[model samples]
Target: MTRIFIQDKATFKTTARTYDDAGFLHVPGRVSKTGTQQYLRRELGLDGDPNARVTVYRPPEEVFAADSLASFDGADVTVMHPGELVNAKNYRKTSVGLIRGPGQQDGDFVKADLVVKDADAIAAIEKRGFVELSAGYTAEYEHSPGTTDDGTEYEYVQRGIRINHAALLPAGAARAGRQARLYDHQPKGSTMSKITLDSGRSVEVQDEATAALVQDHIDRLQKQVTDAQAELDKRQATIDGQAEQITKLQAATADDQITARLKAVTDARARAEKIAPGVTFDSIDPVEIQRQALAKARPSTDWAAKSEAYVQAAFDMAFDQVETTDAHADQKRKLAEDGAKVVTDKAKMPAYDSYTARFTQPQAKE
Candidate 1:
């Protein structure tokens, strides 16, 4: 079996020194019999004490290797166009400053001897349409630090995956420490296995593995949501612009002395058409629809353009909304599948309290 070695680094997580916060240090000072009696009174009080303290904790044994972001797929950057050159200053040690990632230079992701594939990918993106910036690649393994004060070690090895698109992002190592979403990651497609080491240190790549899967899925769903919302927002903005055009036309045409209403209405309608060709209103009456020639003769020259434009915009907006709704509905369905899988798992059988979907409301007729 090919072994992936990573260095054993100390992961002594910071504690807020809450236990030693008080100036006095005594055997029973922090938690005494007297304190327990008062605590019991407070906890068992008929009305809960609003100011009472509560604590939850996990023992040190539960603290696994968790210090840095687990490198799932070593990132790859691809230059899309012919001349596209991703500035690789960060990859260069002189440029990385503090951030580190795959294909990085002086900081050491890619070997100095090898001009890793990333440099070429960036060259592609700089010229034409988007190029494949990066692709997932193998990871360089490092060892886990021993659980205690004594040192433990492992070497880093390669797992294959690369991510490109470096120019779009000036820095790496992810700017998401404090911004990381709290999640219980499911492990899959990881470089390492759930191996146990000596010194009571587990060799499982829990953080990296779990973070990778969870992050992938989270990014996928979030991207979908973001894209849909952006599209809607863009469409709405277009409609707003068109509405403003109508208002301008209305104001200009209202001037009887200038007889500008005809010109204003005509131009406004055209502008609306150009702005939002997806809106649809119940503005089309059968009586009005029959006057094809008369409709053409209508004083508003741009009426057809504007009316159809607004209608198209409205309809397209609704269509996109439905598209988004269906996507979310699909997500809910997938979540349900995962939920069912969890419910069936004998290990988690006891924890199956409830499983729900986003769109769970049964139709009224049904």
Candidate 2:
């Protein structure tokens, strides 16, 4: 495994500071924390595609171990990381201070005394120019997957941590002192991850946070599309149901109309039979049958020039005249039969001929 260089920023008890006549300032502070830290793969200089990121774990045991803490004792201090391990060759040029006391575990962090011997470094600290410390160290990276107690997932764990130096950096240079070490030599853009867009384009987003936001937006839009499709399906089903109902209603209406028409034609044929017996009216329009009836009822009149209402009235009068003439003929026949019976009988009740003449009257013209 290649040795990986890592940096973690520190927080200090700035109020508990002291200065000697030689212009050296000593400050005690917590340097690093035990947790999982995320870093781009390129920052670790590991053999792989460098655009990806990895989460590394620094367990409490490894962070607060006796050997690891002791390595910080007398460690070189620089204004910023020298982009390489601090060794005897670069010690004179890079060192502005030193880790003065034995390093020890403090709560979840590692605490040590940081002494600034360089006047420029002390002046920078006094002016709040150097507000934080970043610990430079080399460690063996054990590639594995694990989760922290707080459910933070990590892909690698740091082992055999050896402190090389502590760099005093400007404020906000590092947000968390977590253990995934970032290589100081990498460019600032190394912290970003490349995200592919829908247009076959790619954009670099800052690590995980921005990427998560983009994913959430995509998920919400997909849900909206699904919901819209569901609504459309529901509406289509309703329309189809209504269409089926309309078809059934239309069929029923047609059946009703056919029944009504058949009844009207049957009624017209019955009337025609009464007016002109033995006349077939099948397959004839009712209006035409009515016209023929009117012509028969009024033979001399120009019935073609008459309105339908006038024709109907004349047909009705003719039917009434036929009913009256038939009733009178039956009465006369009965009277004649009674008179003949009287003539044959010896006991004459009133003479039948005389009785018939008194009861029956002469028929009138149409």
Give the TM-score of each candidate. 0.20, 0.47
> Residues 66-118, candidate 2, lDDT per residue (tens digit)?
89999999998899889988988988899998897677776666777878899
**Model 1 residue 205 CA deviation in Å:** 11
CA shift of 47, model 1, Å: 71
Residue 284 lDDT, candidate 1, scale 0-100: 33
Q: What's the alpha carbon RMSD for model 1?
A: 39.4
Report how far residue 101 has shifted in candidate 1, in Å. Answer: 23
Tell me the lDDT of candidate 2.
Answer: 0.72
The number of the candidate with the highest TM-score is: 2
Model 1 reaches what TM-score against the true structure? 0.20
Q: Could you tell me how far off, in angstroms, the CA of residue 153 lies in candidate 1 after the best superposition?
A: 44
TM-score of 2: 0.47
